[model samples]
Target: MGRIEGKVAIVTGAASGIGAGVASRFLAEGASVLAVDRAPAPAPGTDGARFDSLQVDLAQPDAAARIANRCIERFGAIDILANNAGICDYRLLEDTDDATWDRAIAINLTAMFKLCRATAAVMKARGWGRIINTASIMAERPYPSLTAYTASKHAVAGLTKSVAIELGAHGITANYILPGAVLTGITAPLIAADPTLRETYDTMGVVNRMAMPEDIANAFLFLASDEASFITGHGLAVDGGALLKM
Candidate 1:
């Protein structure tokens, strides 16, 4: 039987990259998925993967409530939640304007906080849930031109931990995953613009190859499954040893 055969999951940022991989994997493992994204529904793309879709810009104040509500309306329960929607703002501290900082925090950290707040309530009522958020290698290690992104990611670690603690008594678990340099929808264009960047990222980690979306998705699958029932308030690093190099 599939690990999460009868579970229902809500996966954000489901249009592309790591989000797409997670959605596809979860479906394969027998879970019904409600995929969320602002760009589009299942674009970039899980062409044949069957799943429900919601288009909502996470930056909106009421987006979180809407997402949680939609998942319930569509699937009846939210057994797993993957707060994977985020943006990577590449700007140095000096070049980062107020708008840039605020936007990054809104998408990367604040939105997660709200969604967790909304979903956890439902999970508590049901007495079972799994919350897996996407932090970054930058969550623990900062880098040049990624000041805003780094700060927001760092906050994700603490935000998730607090949720984990608050929900443990409710048969709920919360954790975040730290992804390293991965070839994704967001990074593909960046690498395309500069072919040299391909090699640079491929070699950033000890593995000597860039991580694929599936690599991160694998971590998500584990944390969401019953296998990780005891793993709460933890930060799982799916980075290919990239943190060591950083």
Candidate 2:
């Protein structure tokens, strides 16, 4: 039997990138998943009745409640919540407008807060749950032109730790993953536009290669599994040792 057999999971940003990868891994582990994203239905990596899709703009005020309701309606329980939907804005502080900053925070940080709040209630009631958040290397380090993204990710780390502390007594675990230079759909275009960018990221990691979506997925699987029951309020860096650099 799979590690998470019979569990019910909710994966946000399931249409593409790391979200899609995580959803696929969950289904393979025998979990029923409700895949949420802004894209239309038919979320990638989903199959049959075990995997359902919900189109949602997570930044919306009602999106969190709607997602929670859909999971309960479809699976009757919430076992795992993966907050992985994020948007990147490439702009320095001086270049970033108020709207840009707000939008980044809304999607990257605020939406996650809403989802956690909605799901934590259910998890607390059940006395068991796992909350996995997707943060970036920027969460701890800085990069030029990523002021808004960095700030939001930094907040995510703190938020996840807070959730862990608050929910640990209820048998709930909250943790975040910090991925570095992952080659995803979003970054593919940028790398294509500037081929040298790939080399820059590749060299940053001690492994001398950028991470694949599956690399991040593997970390998610480990944390979501029962094996990680004691691991909470931690930031697992699947960054190929990039953080070691000065």
Candidate 3:
């Protein structure tokens, strides 16, 4: 039997990248999943797991409630929530407009707050749940032209900690994953266009290679599994030791 057999999970940004990887891993572990993304769901594959796809902009005010309702409707209860949908606006503070900053915070930090708030209620009622958030290596380190992204991610770390403290008594664990230079939908195009970019990112990691989506997915699996029941309010870095250099 799989580690998470019979669990119900909701994975945001599941169309591609790390979100997609997490959804796939969850399905493989015998969990039913609601795969959500702003893009239309992809054609169903032969993963042989219970998978439902939802396309919704999580930044919308009603999106969190809708997602919670859909999970309950489809799976009867919510066991896990993976808040992974995010966008990055590469601009320095001086270059960033108010709209850009707002949008980044809405999607990256605010959406997470909404989702966690909605799902925590469900999880609390059931007395068991797991909330896994996707933060970036930027959550702790700064990069040029990423003022908004960094700020939002740093907020995510704090938010995860707060959720952990609030929900620990209710048997719901809240933790955030910090991933470094993983090859995702966003970075794939850049790497394809300029091969040198791959080397640049690889050098950032002590492993001397860019991280694959599955690399991060492995961390998510552990955090979401019962094995990690005692772990909460932690920032697990799957950054290939890149932060050591930072």
Error of 3 at 235 (Å): 0.2
Q: How well does candidate 3 score on lDDT at residue 193?
A: 95
TM-score of every candidate:
0.96, 0.97, 0.97
**Which 10-residue window in model 1 sums to the lowest lDDT?**
41-50
Preferred candidate (TM-score higher): 1 or 3:
3
Candidate models: Cα lDDT each: 0.90, 0.92, 0.91
Q: Say which prediction, candidate 1 or candidate 3, comes out ahead on lDDT.
A: 3
TM-score of 2: 0.97
lDDT of 2 by residue, 41-80 (tens): 4444445779888999998999999999999999999999
RMSD of 3: 1.2
Tens digit per residue, CA lDDT, model 1, 1-246: 688888989999988899989988998888889889997756323323336889999999999999999988877898999999889877778999999999999999999999998998889999999999999988888889998899999999999999999999999999999998888987999999999999999888899899999999999999999999999999999888988877
Which structure is stronger by TM-score: 1 or 2?
Answer: 2
Candidate 3 matches the true fold with a TM-score of 0.97
Clashes of each: 0, 0, 0
Model 1 per-residue lDDT at 50:
38
Off by over 4 Å in 2: 41-47
lDDT of 1 at 213: 94
Clash pairs, candidate 1, are: none
